[model samples]
Target: MAKHLDLEEQEQLDEIKHFWKQYGNAITWVLIAVLGAYAAWNGYQYWQRSQASQAAAMYDEVEKVSREGDADKLQRAFDDMKSRFASTAYAPQAGLLVAKTLYESGKVDGAKAALTWVAEKSADAGYASVGRLRLAGLLMDSKAYDEALKVLDTGMTEEFAALQADRRGDILLAQGKKPEAKEQYLKAFKAFDDRTDYRRLVMVKLNSLGVDPLADAAAPVAADKGAASK
Candidate 1:
């Protein structure tokens, strides 16, 4: 019986050795692949955090130079931020700050350049819309009416719809396109909420164009009702 038990133990040992010989390399490779992936993910997360930290530091420098009203320093700092961290939110925010400072310092061309960069390259859609709107205003001021219209033609987020329409109306009026201006103003009027002071301003613009927005709306409904009765 003892000899039989020894033979049984040796058989089990032989089976274990056979299993390891068949699958050992594949199991080892699977473990290594999983660990390597985990390590790579951790490395990527660390790199992203490091990038954000560095970008935040540079953005602080931009805000400081802007507040000092130093155009050259502001420009240099903004250039550095854009070069190194354009993917970060802080880069576009710095662009806006630098543009404002440049404009205040009588650097119209510099301001426009910075605004154009933001409009063209910002990662955030909202920032891009703001950049386009401000750049359009500057273009209008320069009497680049066609260029301004082209900038406004770039689509904006829903929140800026009313403001963009109003801006378009202003440009059309400048171009002496009174009928088109009134049409855009009406669109602005409808887009704005009733409680907003901006809506009242839009009404004033409509009135200037000899169209009362409220009356125009009612006239359409009245015409529809009359047609139905007939």
Candidate 2:
């Protein structure tokens, strides 16, 4: 058989060759980039899962140690989680647990340190907010009023706004600043939803201050009724 193609076939073969010649390298590079990105994404997912699993195990150890009332062992376990898997959600959870346990065990400084780490170092914003709030409360209990106020000022998210305001009011009341305390309580009352038990507590605080939340609105109605009678 002859090696040469017929006219139509040769022209079609030439077009195919030209097409590949123009696009072949570009197609290969695009495929390489896509595959590389897919592989990297899968690797990252696997790494995240591994980190979470290991962190969870460490947290379980911390919990057990806390239950056994071995504060030293609990601290060590928390330290491991913080050092090795701080990127995982479980690490922050463990930090909170450790702080609570330490505080209950009368380890005030240890509790403060743990909360500080979660506040300053945790990647989760919600956890950071919790840490900041708890830290502020501890500082207030220790009578570091200005320091507590400063801690409360930063890093709390809006979801914790009511609690933050209420805590500030408590600190102010502790310092004998009744006017400032009432102002903060009013803010907390407004921030907390009406149905929440916490809001009821705020209402009680306002009542003690002789400022009923509904009183302002009721005053106008009572005045209107009196004027109408006159």
Candidate 3:
């Protein structure tokens, strides 16, 4: 019985050896690939985190210089960050800040150039929208009415609808289209929440056009009641 048990054990050992000889290299390679992929994924995540952290620090630097309103320092830092980390979210945000600084410093053309870059190159839609909106405002200030309208015609989000309408109304008013301007003001007024002081401002615009939108809305009802009385 002892001999038989030894023979059985030896046979099992030989079978295991044969199995290892056949699949050992393949199993080793599979484990290597899996571990290599996991390591690479971890490395990539760490690299992205490091890059974003660096970009965030650069953005803070931009903000500090921007607050000082030093155009030269602001431009230098903006150029550095834009060149080094253009793909980061902080880049476009920094661009907007720098553009605003330039605008406040009476650098109109420089501000427009910065805003155009952000409008065209920003990866984030919200930043891009802000760039377009600001550019439109500037163009309107310059009396570049067609360009301003073009900027606004490019699909604004719901949050921007009222501002867009307000701008459009201003452009139309400038062009001597009182009826169209009144329509835009009405849209803006209705689109805005009551709490927005902008709504009262829109009301002022409507009054200027001699078309009280609320009165126009109630006129039909008043006419219906008059007909019923007749």
The residue ranges of model 1 lying beyond 4 angstroms of the native Cα positions read: 1-27, 223-230
Global lDDT of model 3: 0.88
Predictions: Cα RMSD each: 2.7, 2.8, 3.7
lDDT per residue, candidate 3, 29-144, as tens digits?
99999999999999999998998999999999999999998888888998899888888899889988888999999998888888887887887777887888888889988999
Assess each prediction's global lDDT (C-alpha) against the native: 0.91, 0.91, 0.88
Query: Across residues 1-230, which tens digit of lDDT does each residue of candidate 1 receive?
Result: 99999999999999989998999899999999999999999999999899999999999999888888888888999999999999988888888888888988899999999999989999988998899889998889899999999998875788899989999998999999999998889999999999999899999988877888898789989999999999
Please name the candidate that would achieve the greatest TM-score relative to the true structure.
2
The global Cα lDDT (0 to 1) of model 1 is 0.91
On lDDT, the stronger of 2 and 3 is 2
Question: Which pairs clash in model 3?
Answer: none
Position 176, candidate 3: lDDT: 82
Give all TM-scores, in the order shown: 0.85, 0.91, 0.78
Worst 10 residues of 3 by lDDT: 151-160
The TM-score of predicted model 3 comes to 0.78
Ranking by lDDT: 2, 1, 3
